[model samples]
Every structure is written in structure tokens, then in C-alpha cells.
Target: MSEDGARDDGRQQRQELGSFLRRQRERLDRTAYGLPPAGRGRAVGLRREEVSYLSGVSVTWYTWLEQGRDINPSRQVLDAVATTLRLTDAEHDYVLSLVGLAPRPATRADAVDIAPAQVQRFLDALDEHPAYALAPDWGIAGWNKAYERLYPGVATTAGENRNLLWLVFTDPSVRSLLDDWDDTSRRFLAEFRAEAGPRLSDPRYRDLISRLRAASVDFDTRWNEHGVGGFVSRERVFRHPELGRLVFEHHQLRPSDHLDLQLVVYVADAETRRRFARTKD
Candidate 1:
């Protein structure tokens, strides 16, 4: 890369870092930090001084940091600021990448759009349990017959509409399938936000968010809240139209060779296994 190109890239990274920090800071309630809430007309987030004080950084330096001024913040300082803002694991890594403290994540463009044959075979080998592969942007790249049976829409949803987050929010069938749509949807949104990180500004991410905001009132409301969380493997309950009530442990894995692709699987217990077997018969 040319010297000029490197400079431009650094500038963009700083700007994105500043914006991300500001958003995270603003979304937090001052009261949660044992500080008084912002009064009527004041800005909603913690003031710069408050953050600096909490982070033990100089207020002037912190203000400059938010302004995207040409400055280098030490890893320790960044860590303190991230802690003060309660950034998640992914968010912290993103902040590090912005300042050349961590390696940048691979872009979706570098990844393949379809699941590898080996991955598809693995899904197929899952037998009755439903399993699917998710591309970097949460696109439903591939799935097994069991997954198709679990969510028939996956087999039919085409183009941009094939994204998991899009389906979770916009598909009425998904709402009907999940036993706890409100909680499940919110959790999914939070996880997506955390995973998206610096790529939130990418065109595809922006387009998806805009469409969801326009399509679902729930998504719009929750999105404005700026909630972020890491993914957790847990028991998920579903009310299948034909299968009735089903229980499974929702889990996800990343292939060593294809780190960007996520393999999401639903592992069934004995009762759920019997239910799946009955459907097969």
C-alpha cells in the first residue's frame, strides 16, 4: 500500500472507532454507573468527563479520542475505556483493531457464499437433528433435509431475504415457531450486533438494518436501543406446526478451515429425537 493509502486507512479506522465508542457510551444509562441520569434537555449518554473520570484517562485526551483527532491511545488506555463502556468481547476486539492493537477481521468478500461439500456432508450426517450453515453475514448458505423440514422457508427464501436475522424478524412463521419470540428475537438481534462489530457500517449490513427497520416495528425499536451480546448455547423450544412442542440445545461451531462460516445445529434429546423419528416414519 502507498503511504497516502495507509494514511487514509488509518484515518477511516480512527473515525469508525470514535463513532463506535460514542454509540456505546450513549446507549448506557448513567444511573447504572451510579451517576445521576441526564436531565430533560441534556444529552442522553455519559459525558466525556464522566467517561474519562471513570476510565482514569485525561478528559482532554478522551475528548480528542472521540473527535477522531490524530492520536495514538495505548492498549491499556483503550482497555480501560472499553471496560468503562462495558463493551462485549467482539466489541473490544473491534476497538483494538481500530488502533492497530489487534488483527483486523476478514471481510465477507474474502469468504465463500456457499458451504463446502465437507460441511454439507457433516450436516447431512446429523441425521434427524436439524443443522444449517451460515455465511459471514448470516446468510443461510446451506442446510440438511432435517433443517428444511424444521424451517421450510429456508429452502424457499431467496436472495437477500435468505439472511437469518432477516427471517427472525420479518418472517411470521419464525415468530410462530419460537416458543418465546420476544426473548428469542431480541437475543438474536443482540448477538448479531456484537458479531457485526466494525462491519456494521458495511453496505450489506446497512441495507439489512434499513430494511428491517422499515419492515418490523419491533426490530426498529430494539435496534435503537443498541443492545449487544455474545452468543450462548442453550436450550431452545419450538412449537412446530406438525411436530408439536420440541426441545433442543441450540449450538454453533466454526470450521477450522473456514472460520467465517458458522455451523448452527439443534441437538435433540430423547423425547425430541423420538418426535423427529416419528416425523421420519
Candidate 2:
């Protein structure tokens, strides 16, 4: 392509990005988030100024962005903007593509299937252990009966509500099942930060953050602290109201054929193994 054509393409991308951002902001109910309309005048959607305030950018910078100026936004800045606009994971990636910063998603014609069902069967085979699979974005892609028996309904949330982080932060049942809620939540977030480093700007990560912030003040604190931890498999003890202290050593495994999937398995202690046997009764 000629230099002029290239420049035109770039300009077109910016325009598209600005338009996408406007739609996302306008569609979001300010009242739902407890923030008044942020744009100047009676603008239909969130104002550029509102976005700037929330995204930690100067009004001028944000204005330039919405005005379709040929400016490059960093990943962190894009992440903040996506969060402020409340974009979904898919939409977040779309905005990046508009800026020529990310590759466009493959069309269904060319796209392969996401998670496979066999993964669930594999989890089932680890009958003694609680096992589940997480998608690249950390949604529960699949789980064995053992996992469901332990963290019931966690990996099996119907529809779009099937996110592991969402369950961890928002679900009261899941919360009550934890032995140390605060410690466990923080560790999950830290591991998330580590796993999500390259994908910080992606809508999937931003959407999870937004939901967690809305649901848990503790999540808000730890996220803002910017702590990161390695994703080492560790032990956990879930204190059930009736089941008492159930101990297990959990570890993560990646399927060789599916790089985007993570398999998590939990090995129980002797007592917990016995408890597992009885629970099946």
C-alpha cells in the first residue's frame, strides 16, 4: 500500500475505535455504576472527560483519542479506557484491532472450536481429585464430577456467568466455602495478574476486574496494589459447614494440544480422601 493509503487506513482505524468507544460508553448505565453522566453537555453517552477522569489521563489526551487523532495509546492506557467504557472481553480486543494494535478475530468460517468436551472427561478420570479446566480468559471451560461435588455449581454456571474469578469474588456460596477468604482472593488475583500480564488490555481481564470491583471492596484494594505472584500450584483447605476442614494439594497443567486451556487438579490428603469417599454416599 502507498504511504497515503497507509495513512488513510490508520485514520480509518482511529475513527472506528472512537466510534466503538462511544457506543460502549453510551450503552452503559451510569446509574448502575453509581456515577453520574460524565460527558460535557447533554451528550448521549459518557463524555470524553468522564473517561479521562476514570482512565487517569488528561482531558486533552482523552479528547484527542475520541477526536480520532493519530496518537498511539499504551497497553495500560488502553486497559484503563476499556475498563472505563465497561467493554466485554470481545469488545476490548476489537478496540485494539481498530487501533491496529491487535489482530482481528478470525471469522467463524476460519475459526476453530474453542474448548473441547474431552477435557471434561479427562477431569472425570481424575476421580479422586477435584479437577477442572479454565479457558485462556479464566472461565471454567470444563470440570469433573469431583470438582462439582466440592465447589458445586462453580464451574457450571449457566451462560456468560461461568467465570472462575466471578464465582470467587461474587458468589456467596463459593465465598462461604473458602477457609480464608481474604488470603485466597488476594492470591487468586495475584496469580491472575501474573497470568494476565500480556492480556492486561484485553476486555476479558478488564471485565473481570470491573465485576470484582463492584462486588468486593477487598478485590478493589488488592487490584489497585498491583501485586503479582507466580502461578504455582498450592494447597488449600476448604472449611465446609458440615464437611469440616478438607485439605488438598492443588496443581495446574496445560494440555499439550490446547495451549489456551489450563487443567487444575487437586489431590486430597488421607483424611480428605476418606471424606471424599463418604461425600459420594
Candidate 3:
């Protein structure tokens, strides 16, 4: 890249940093950090001075950093700022990248590819339980028969519409299938937001967001909320028509060779496990 081009990129990154910082601050509650709550006519979230104090930096320096001024902060200062914002893992990485320093590579849709046959075999091996794989974009990359029966149409959905967020927000069947659809949807959205990271400015990510907004009002509202979460194992209860109530915990596992793909497996409780065996019989 030319010197001019590099300078332009730096300027753009600074602008993004400023915007992201403001959004995070606006959404954070002062009281959540043991600080005074917003008084009448004051800002809804923590004030700039409060953040500076908490981050152990001078108010002028924090203000300059937020204002997109040409000032480079040390890694220590950046880490402090990130802690003050209570950023998610992805958000923390993105903030570092904006300053021409990337602690980790950003996961993108383009990086997703067909899962190896070995991955399919692994999912197939878990025949008695539900198991599947999700691509970087959260698309249904592969699944087993048990997973297909578990989620119904999810495994069969074609094209990019197979995305988890798309199905959760647009598919009526999905809304009816999950016992706690609202809670599940919110958490999934938060996970998706975390993965999106600095790629939010990318055309593909923006297009996906636009389509999601058109598909569901709730998704749009949640997206605007800027909530972020990690993908971790969690227990969920499902109402099965023939089997009655079933409990299962799901986890997201990444293969050492394929960091972009996530293997999601559902483990049933003792009673649910018995129900699955009986249903198979």
C-alpha cells in the first residue's frame, strides 16, 4: 500500500475507534461499575471523566482518544480502557486492531469453507445424540440424523438463509420449536455480534444486518442494543410433543485444524436420554 493509502486507513480506523467507544459508553450503566447513577439531565452511561478515572488515565488523554486525535496509546493503557468498557472478547480484539495492533485475527464469513469429511463422520458418530457443525457465519454446515430430528427444518435449509440468526428471527417454525425462543434468540444475537467484530463495516456483514432488520423487528431492536456475549455451554429445556419435556445442554467446540468451524453437540439429561432411546426404539 502506498504511504497515502496507509495514512487514509489509519484515519478511518481512528474514526471507527471513536464511534465504537461512544456506543459502548452510551450503553453501559454507571451504577453497574459502582459509580453514581446518571442524575437528571446527565448522560445515560458513564461520563468521559469517570471512565478516565477508572481507567487510571487523565481526562484529557481519554477525551483525545475518543475524539480521534492523533495520539497513540500504549498497550497497557489500551487494556485498561478495554476493562473499563467491559468489552466482550471480540470487542477487545477489535479495539486493539483499530490502533494498528491486532492481538487476534478477526473471524470473517469469507474464511468459512466446506467442513472436511472427517468432521461429518464425527457428527455421525454421535448418532444417539443431536450434533451439528456451524460455519463462521453460523450457517448449518453439517449435521447428523439426530440433529435433523432435533431441529426439524434447520438441517435442510438451503443457501445463506440457513444462518442461525435468520432462522431464529424469520422462521415461524423455529419460534415455536424453542421453549424459550426469546431468551435463546437474544443470546445467539449477542454471540453473533461478538463474532462480527471489526467486520461490521464490511459489505457482507452490513447486508446480513439489513436483511435481518427487514425479517424481524425484534432482531433489529436487539442489534441496535449492542449486547455482546460468548458462545459457551448452557442448559436449555425443550418441549417435545411425543417425548414430553426434555432437557439438554449444548456446547460450542472448535477443532484444532479448523478454527473457523464450531462443533455444537447436545447432551441430554438422564430422563431425556431414556426418552431418546425409547423414541429410537
**How far in Å is the alpha carbon of 53 misplaced in model 2?**
48
Q: What is the lDDT of residue 177 in candidate 2?
A: 92
lDDT of 3 by residue, 24-142 (tens): 88889766787665778453688899889999999999898888888898878888999999997778988998897868556446645456899989998987678888887777788
List model 2 lDDT by residue over 190-261, tens digit each. 887777777766776677678789888877888899989977777898977767899999798988777578
> Which rank order by lDDT, best down to worst?
1, 3, 2
As for model 3, its CA RMSD to the true structure in angstroms is 18.2
lDDT of 3 at 116: 82
TM-score for candidate 3, please give it: 0.61
- Runs of candidate 1 with Cα error greater than 4 angstroms are 1-101, 106-112
What's each prediction's TM-score? 0.63, 0.58, 0.61
Give one clash count per candidate, in the order shown: 0, 3, 0
lDDT of 1 by residue, 1-281 (tens): 99999999999988998898989988887778888767684445898899999999999999888888899999899999999999876789889989989744545433456799999999999988899998877888889888888888997888668889899989999999999999999998998888887687677777888999999999999999999998899999999999899999999999877777889999998898898887773
Give Cα-based local distance difference scores for all models.
0.87, 0.77, 0.82
Give the lowest summed-lDDT range of ten residues in model 1: 103-112
The lowest-lDDT stretch of 10 consecutive residues in candidate 3 is: 104-113
Top lDDT model: 1
For candidate 3, list the clashing residue pairs, or say none.
Answer: none
